[model samples]
Target: MSPVEPFSDDSPLGASGAEGVRALRVAVTRPLSGERLENLLRDAGHAPVHFPLTRIEAPSDPRPLARGARALLRGEMDVLLLTSVRAVRSLAQALETVAEGPWRRPEGLQVWVIGDATGAAAARMGLVPDRIPEHFVAEQLLEEASSWARLDGLRILFPRAAAGRSLLPETLARAGATVTLVEAYRSVDDGEEADRLVRAMGRGELDLVTLTAGSQARVLARAMRGTRPALRCAVPMVAIGPATRMAMVAAGLPEPTVAAPHTVEGVVAAVKTVAGGLQ
Candidate 1:
């Protein structure tokens, strides 16, 4: 007998297995290095395809970040919101460049993270957050933080990428908090990889496509717009969060299978469950 397939011999939705045998193929669009998502897909007997859509680049001018580091050390901001681990790592590195000794974080500083993974990243830098919003999106974080009356006079520092929407900063400002938005990095579109992904989709060599951010989903949509074949078939789009899912919908894609908790593990689990159901 042939090797037993790990994926269930199931049909698409309510269809019968004899109608068609579903083969799993996953497209990874993020700049992930580990084998975590790939391993999960392979465990479900899916073909994992990696095509990074964006690349993270450090800021050319480190002077502003260095200044921010000094301010952070002096406890200039009452609250620090860390959105991604990459940002935290970059900020820590910038701080180390100008900081002396063991590098101690500000005392009495309130830190808030979007999620557990981001919180873990902050912890790695010896900065424990005082609060972590349940929802991992900017709007949710704003809503949750806005309920605190103590934030009235607080100065919040948000270090993130140069591009992207300004909803978070705007919301915080409306809630009576002085927000200082700092750019720590930038995300550049990898046109070469985007072209490759478009080709793969056109040839029907790709199956599942995972999007971690709204910007990435939009980028993929733009790439698909120029591809002949990708514009015809409706490929499965898996989003990491509600914001990404909304972005996918806005980009003219159907509602995607959304991951809960908006973490890497959540994304993997959601993909496995959906792929297994489609098998």
Candidate 2:
């Protein structure tokens, strides 16, 4: 397969001119779960190489997700917050297990997604998100949730990664919402991929690295230190948002050029902006 392909008309970046945009050898630390983002990067004239960092899978202990599913079916959950598309799919499996049949979302329960991508995932499962944050970030989700006066006495179910931060649940509790945080999935680093990334860095093949999740940032740091001598390549990092950027910084990596609007298109724009400025 070609390392880079021409952007298609269906791609969001199709209409965007690719001329004069310096295409960097960008390293994406996650597998291509969706090709939209990668297409956008290519549309903006970048060669994106996927060096998978973490693999997403169902959690070992499924009881927490099962209970959350039961709560929803019992009409006890007022709102369901999904941070990632994987969470939505995992929750769907848990729901099927709990219901012992095809799961139908209970009426009167609101669904909130982190962004358009998650919303699209929910849509595939016959769900329509009640709310999508203006900014695709957890902080914005909390802000949006807090704006709804009815949340003061509501029950919210959040099924996310096992290592997810407690900020969402804690913030909701402070706002008087009863929140149930369930571990629906586990995101663990792929050691083989990590080694490959370190090797690539050692060969000085990557020009820019994009980290979308904090966990990915942590994994990348571990990979950089995988060799006896650390692979201290000076490639610029591009974080999808502030949280990921913070994680990268905390791991002693260089501060990243954060993507604004927090979307695939946004990342393309951010990279183009950086590239344009360098000329």
C-alpha RMSD values across all candidates: 5.5, 4.6
lDDT of 1 by residue, 179-264 (tens): 88888888888777777777776766666788888878877878777555535355677899988899888987667889986876
lDDT by residue for model 2 (23-76), tens: 566677765544777777766777678776888777989898999999999999
What is the clash count for each candidate, in the order shown? Answer: 1, 0
Error of 2 at 14 (Å): 21
Off by over 4 Å in 2: 1-17, 226-233
| Reference-based TM-score of each model | 0.86, 0.86
Worst 10 residues of 1 by lDDT: 11-20
> Model 1 reaches what TM-score against the true structure?
0.86
How many steric clashes does model 1 contain? Answer: 1
- On lDDT, the candidate that comes out on top is 2
